[model samples]
Target: MARILLADDDEATRDLVKRALETDGHTVSITQDGAEALDTLTSAAATFDVLVSDVHMPGLDGVALAKRAIAAAPDLKLLLMSGFAEELDRAQALKSANLGVIIKPFTLDQIRAAVRALLA
Candidate 1:
């Protein structure tokens, strides 16, 4: 099982994702914003295998968090989620070879596959 850090401003969405990932046997740590997510990624005693974050957080959007998180945890696998077209485009423009974008309204299997792709 993989250790995961998940961030999303929406409480319901965060909870749903946490549960879904946990049900898949991944250990997940959840945060409400990118700043918190970054803090956890940089300060956690244990290393996370994946970072799944929403792109529209209030402080430190997902893309920015990904930048800092990669510096803090170079091996981190990143998967970003966004419902907006503009945000998705921004994520794509990032063009990091290790970055993956999971469009909103995606199935749980899609999320699992995205992370697996990065990890693989």
Candidate 2:
């Protein structure tokens, strides 16, 4: 199973997604905002197969988090999710391997498939 870091400002959203991902057998460490997420990623405990973050969050935002994380772990896989997914900067996705953007309002199955696809 893949190890994952999940970030979102919405508690409900984070909880729901984290539960879904965990149910899929991935080890997920979750944070309430992008800044906390970045801190977790840069910390010594930051060993993860992928980062699933909400595109719009306070302090850092998902794009900035992605940049910082890639600088720290270039081969790290990234998955960005948002209601305004199109507003996400695609440049980061191009720079990282296994990067994907998933639109919000997704079903559990959809999110599971997206993460599995990243691992595959």
Candidate 3:
């Protein structure tokens, strides 16, 4: 089980992901946007094992959030989601052993698998 921080603008997506991960026994904390997610991360007393975020958001985007999240917690694992090819490409620069990207409209299994891979 892992502690997961999930951020997305869409309520359905957020709920879907939170439930999906929670079913796997992970403790999930959700946020509506990148800015809120970052705030939660920085303020959290306990460290989260993973961050699952949507690439696009109102206040701050996932890519920027990822960068700051890593700086705040170097060991944190990241999974960035986006439907746009360009947005996915932008995240590629941040790719590493601890980072991954998932195309949006993903099946529940796909997202679960992606997070599992990061945890692994």
Candidate 4:
């Protein structure tokens, strides 16, 4: 199973995504804020196969966190999720950051598919 760090400011959405990922045989670590998510990635003992984070959040946001995570672990895989379609345009901005993104309001199937594709 892949270890996934799930960061979302919304508790319900985080829980839902966590459950879905876990159900798909992924080990998920849930974080409520971007700062905490970045902390986990920067920690010396931190370990995660992939990161799934919301685009908008307090104290850093997913893009910033992804940048930091990539610096910390260049081989790390990232999956960013956002409710804003405008953020998709920023995908190019993340090219050097080494990350993939998904628009919000996505289905469990979509998430699972993304995860599978990344893991593959």
Candidate 5:
């Protein structure tokens, strides 16, 4: 099973995604804020196969976190999710970060497929 870091500001959304990923047999570590997510990635004990994060948050934000995380862990697989696809598209950092983007309101099937594809 792949180890995944799930970062989202919304508690409900985080819970939903976490349950879905866990149900698919993946191990998950969840963080409710972008800063916390970054801290986890930078932590000495932090290790994960993939990172799934929301694009917008109070601090740091997903694209910034992904960029920093990738800098620290070049091989880290990143999957970014957002309700605002337009905003994500406009964020040049996201494109430069080279991470996969999943539009929000995704189905469990979509999440499972993304995890499998990334892990594969």
Candidate 6:
């Protein structure tokens, strides 16, 4: 089991992802946007093993968040989600060993597997 931090602006997406990961026995903490997720990552008492975030968000986008999160916690793993090809391309540009990307409209199993890949 892993301690995961998940960030997505959409409530339904957030809830669906939270449940999907939890079903896989991972402890998930959620935030509505990247800024909040960053706060949780930097200030929270508990250190997260992985970060699952949406690529497009209001204030701080997932790509920016990923960059900052990695700097703050070098060992943190990243899984970014997006339906847009351009955004996915942006996420891929980071090119970190611990980073991964999932397309939106994903099945629960797909998301679970993506997170599992990062953990593995």
**Model 6 CA deviation exceeding 4 Å by range:** none
Q: lDDT tens digits, residues 42-91, model 1?
A: 78486898999999999799989988887887778889999998998888
Any runs in candidate 2 off by more than 4 Å, and if so which? 89-94
> Please, what are the lDDT tens digits per residue for candidate 6 over residues 24-117?
9999999999999999999959699999999999999999999999899989999999999999999999989999999988999999999999
TM-score per model over all chains: 0.92, 0.92, 0.96, 0.93, 0.91, 0.98
Please state every model's RMSD to the true fold in angstroms: 1.3, 1.6, 0.9, 1.4, 1.8, 0.7
Cα lDDT of model 3 by residue, 64-100, tens digit: 9999999999999999999999999999888667899
- The predicted structure with the larger TM-score, 5 or 6, is 6
Assess each prediction's global lDDT (C-alpha) against the native.
0.87, 0.86, 0.92, 0.85, 0.84, 0.96
Go through the candidates in order and give the clash count of each: 0, 0, 0, 0, 0, 0
Q: What local lDDT does model 2 show for residue 71? A: 88
lDDT of 5: 0.84
CA error at residue 86 for candidate 5, angstroms: 2.2
User: Highest TM-score among the candidates is held by which one?
Assistant: 6
What order do candidates take by TM-score, descending? 6, 3, 4, 1, 2, 5
Candidate 6: residue 69 Cα off by (Å): 0.5
Tell me model 4's lDDT, rounded to 2 decimals.
0.85
Error of 5 at 108 (Å): 1.0
lDDT per residue (tens digit) for residues 40-96 in model 4: 888888899999989889888888888888888888888989878777667548785
Model 5 weakest lDDT span, ten residues long? 90-99
Query: Which is the leading candidate under lDDT?
Result: 6
Cα deviation in Å at residue 71, candidate 1?
1.7
Q: Tell me the spans in candidate 5 whose CA falls farther than 4 Å from its real position.
A: 90-98
Candidate 3 lDDT score relative to the true structure:
0.92
lDDT of 1: 0.87
Candidate 1 least-lDDT 10 residues: 38-47
Query: How many residue pairs clash in model 1?
Result: 0
